[model samples]
Target: GGGTGMIGDPGGKTAERVLLDAETVARNAEAIATQASTLFAGADFTLLNNADWLSQLNMIEFLREVGKHFTVNVLLQRDFIKDRVKDPEHGISYTEFSYALLQAYDYLHLHREYGCDLQIGGSDQWGNIVSGVDFIRRKTGNTVHAFTWPLLTDKAGKKFGKSESGAIWLDPAKTSPFAFYQFWLNAEDESLGEYLLKMTMLSKTEIGAALELHKRDPKERHGQQLLAREATTLVHGAEEAAKAEQVSQVLFGEGTLEGLDADALQMLKAGAPSREIQTGTGIVDALVVARLASSKREARQFLADESVLLNGDPITDPSETLGSDDFYNGLALLKRGKRNICVLILK
Candidate 1:
């Protein structure tokens, strides 16, 4: 249920990554536990650190015990090792070559301490998992079971958890719930059926209904809606999901700024693309900086035509400087006329 020494699993023929600093790894471990708390709330889970035992092993003792079982010939036969060592651009490093032994020791230590009978990981981890099982059997005379799920992939065979923007991070600060929802909402039709079944805990009947609806009318976006709702609720909870849904409805639907609370309005603006301004900047300067208008002359013309809105209301004066009062709950809502909106959060 948890990872030990995350020397960063080698997969997809990737170059060896710089190992995490002790402090950074500690922080990452804590953060992962926090995120998992919501999903595995009632499950029996234990977070462990391999360094607890790994750091204590003397070099002579380690070689006599754990290292004796592994041979260089067998090690080089691993797909990751063979591919990386052969690749001209990214030859495998010695530290990465030793990764398997380190990982196997983690399993051995866990078995000795907790009597952990099973290890599970992605299908790609079969070699590593088997290595751990074999090490345990050879050293301790105990049988252990290991299972791995097939790597979750889309119809095109690309991994499911990434997007054009980047990895879909579990941290809200890294990727907002709205953006996260949008990512799933935009899943290709071909992938929706498999994705819903694999990723969500929804029952078979509910998943089947969503899939049927998607097939009947793709434009109705039943799959997208269900994906967004379930994912958002899982990550941010029902309350935050409801708030994000309301915001999306107002921004993309027929609703206006009047429908939003001050805090919600501020969040909306923060989510949008924006530019910051000094305290003394005039409305004209702010408009130009935000690119709502192309030039100062165009900005003035727009202002004169009553085509500029601050917080969704028309502004008639070009000379008006952005004042503290213009900000709704500490965020300035800017719009060219009433349609194109940008939010400015005062620093």
Candidate 2:
């Protein structure tokens, strides 16, 4: 299990962090741990809380034993620390200043307890990692290694998170698997190659072939599809990834009513605008009730123009009625034009 060391990090961030309550931190730790367990299910892993050990250490003892290995000159040389020290108004706090040392101590604790030698993190942690490596060598005279992966970003160099709803969470409750899948499915063409190799477990040969396939038919999105499925499965389960793909096809790709399970229906119902209508409601009235149209006149006009569809089938008849028979398992899907979608619940 990897420890949640970066949760409170203020490094490279230009502002002070809003502190989270202990209960909130615990809940978030549990959620992040659950996601990690799913992502690395096959491996022997444990989820560690930095507060568990870090909180137990006496400040004086830490400064005496661990802190003595590094000098002030070296500590002040880290880019983020230098920037913070130089800033006048947005100056770093003692808590923020010692964060690197605390992280370095976390590495030493883990190494001593579990023989975990290799410390892997984002590129921003290079300075902190070196501190840990040096500390371990001074204390135990043993060699340790550190590896940092490049930070993932879009072509615009903006962090690859923050969807319309903000940070893309691993918790399905926070960011539904359907939206997560759509995020990858809509990857930009220029960043597709980098995302394919970095974010997925796809083989090099398979990626090479897919890149060529994507080039030949970029509109088909062969590479994006593969990356989407692989990445989604790696985080969420295979069953969820499949359902997400199916939901995509049914909603935006091709239209369908078949193979929709209860979970899939729940996702669709939660995502689309919906209302419950009586059994005898006319289609035009239902349309207005569902906000597919502003008025009966507009609803009728939509029908006349052949722009209204019920369950993906266009309804040209203005006099059509919806009853129990028109409902699929008590839910009816409505579409106006090609994009406006609504779900109607039959009561």
Candidate 3:
């Protein structure tokens, strides 16, 4: 249910992870919990901290109970182990070596305690999942199932959320709703099908129909649009998703700011070039201050050429000053030419 396994991971890097302290782990757990709740909203679910059971596990008792079922040869042959075993200088540690055993016992405990029969996770967890299934079978003589999906990846095979920009955090504060929406909106066309199937709740029939429409007109980005809207709504709620989409549209000149809200205003403030200015600050000063223009002369040139847009309207007066009347909910959207954008936060 979580990525805590990464803490004991040997498959990812040549070196062992720098273990997180208790307080840091607990802090991250809260963030992960909030993300999981939103992404799985309306589902009946109970979260578990593997640390609760794993930490208290008795090592000698574990070897006698669960470790006997696994032969050293088979465990040594595991791909993760093979990678480390081949590199004597960076060989695996006992803690990481035994991580799979802890995970196996986890499945056995869930089976005995909760009647949990099926475990689903990424393909990278295949070895751990099998260990659990085998441990449960040897212990209780009951069969459990392990289902693994294809590892979600981009065209270059790098895992999703592990992009060049770093993990796409589920927290809205870390990644604003608008930015979250745009990540999917900007997904590569070749990767859309897999992303649609694995990441969204849309049915095959619907996705198929959309893909067909997209193929005929790739320029419109119908598939990417559907993926963006659905994925954003799933993570951030529909209302926030809509506001993000609206903010994106209004900023891009494709739509008006008629429905802009306070949340969207703050999103722009946090994400774009912005500066807090008192009401009635000179327009040229505001522009230079926000870095939309480099100097007063450049700011004046933009104003003269009708390249400055305030709240989606042309600002022709070079001497005009920003006022409360220009702000929407205490923030004003300022644009220079097509791509340069800034926000003036009313103090």
Best by lDDT: 2
Better of 1 and 2 by TM-score: 2
Expressed as tens digits, the lDDT of each residue in 171-192 for candidate 3 is: 8777778888888888899999
lDDT against the true structure, each candidate:
0.75, 0.81, 0.80
Best by TM-score: 2
Ten-residue stretch with the least lDDT total in model 2: 1-10
How high a TM-score does candidate 2 get? 0.89
lDDT of 3: 0.80
Stretches of model 1 off by over 4 angstroms after superposition: 1-6, 88-90, 160-165, 274-347
How far is 21's C-alpha from truth in model 3 (Å)? 2.7
lDDT of 2 by residue, 1-347 (tens): 12334337666777667777777777777777777787888998877777788767897998998778878798788788788788897877777777777778888998999898999988877877878898899989888999998878888887654333346767888778888888899899999899989988988998999999999999899888888898888878899899888877776666575568888988777766789888888889988998989999999999999988887788988788887877777888888886788888877
Against the true structure, candidate 2 has what lDDT?
Answer: 0.81
Per-prediction TM-score to the true structure, in the order listed: 0.76, 0.89, 0.86
How well does candidate 1 score on lDDT at residue 58?
80
- What is the number of backbone collisions in each predicted candidate, taken in the order shown? 0, 2, 0
